[model samples]
Target: MNPPNDPRTAADDDAALRALYGRAQAQISAGTTARLHRARHAATTGSTASPARRSWAWPAAAGFAALFALAIGMQSLAPPAPPTATPAPVLAEADGAAALDDGVADALATYEESPDFYLWLAANESTLLAME
Candidate 1:
């Protein structure tokens, strides 16, 4: 049943909102009402026409799926490349006559150049320890 006062319940509220549209027809200006009608008509017509344009989305998706399937099929049908051969690891060696020739040369050079220092260190090591 319709309430005599302002709407309180949900049904009354919904009915009150619906009645506002009829009231708006008398209150709103003629130019504003005509613009609203044109806008509503345009929106409904645009939505009905959109499905014809949106139908391309499905076919585009199907084409992409077909391309992906074709790529996978082609890859499986083709032969794989051959494995590469690796070279064997080499062993490093020196001739017996020249084995570590630089180590012996360095030791002999230092001893020959500073024989006096080596001799002094050997003779005076005990005195050095006493000083420490």
Candidate 2:
């Protein structure tokens, strides 16, 4: 015959459930124990690393640094343009000769003011001509 419906079975079931709950709580308190093995296994297989990681990272980094330096130097080192060509000399020799002749004409006007001055000047003109 089926055993009598005992209330003790219900108490046993309650005890079992409490034991399972305590174990789960303890595992949780121990801080994520179940995922650690899987994480380590993934690292061992290189699954945790990026698949498309470049192998020439160092050279590429150096090249980029060199390019950055080159760009900065180019920005700072712009050369100044040369001065433009100037126009040719405007005053000729005949203009200078005309200026000297105009000065001599003014001196001859002063020379005509006295007759004794003219006689003395005429005597000294030979000495001046010899010096010249």
Using TM-score, give the best candidate's number. 1
| Per-residue lDDT of candidate 1, residues 8-120 (tens digit) | 67677788888997897789998998988877998987755345888899999999999999999999999999999987644444454366787799888988799797888
Candidate 1 — which residues are off by over 4 angstroms? 1-49, 93-132
Backbone clash numbers for all candidates listed: 0, 0
TM-score of each: 0.39, 0.24
**lDDT value for candidate 1?**
0.81
Please report the TM-score between candidate 2 and the true structure: 0.24
Instruction: Go through the candidates in order and give each one's C-alpha lDDT.
Output: 0.81, 0.81
10 residues in a row with least lDDT, candidate 1: 88-97
Model 2: runs farther than 4 Å from truth?
Answer: 1-39, 44-54, 81-132
Clashing residue pairs in candidate 2 (N, C-alpha, C atoms within 3 angstroms): none
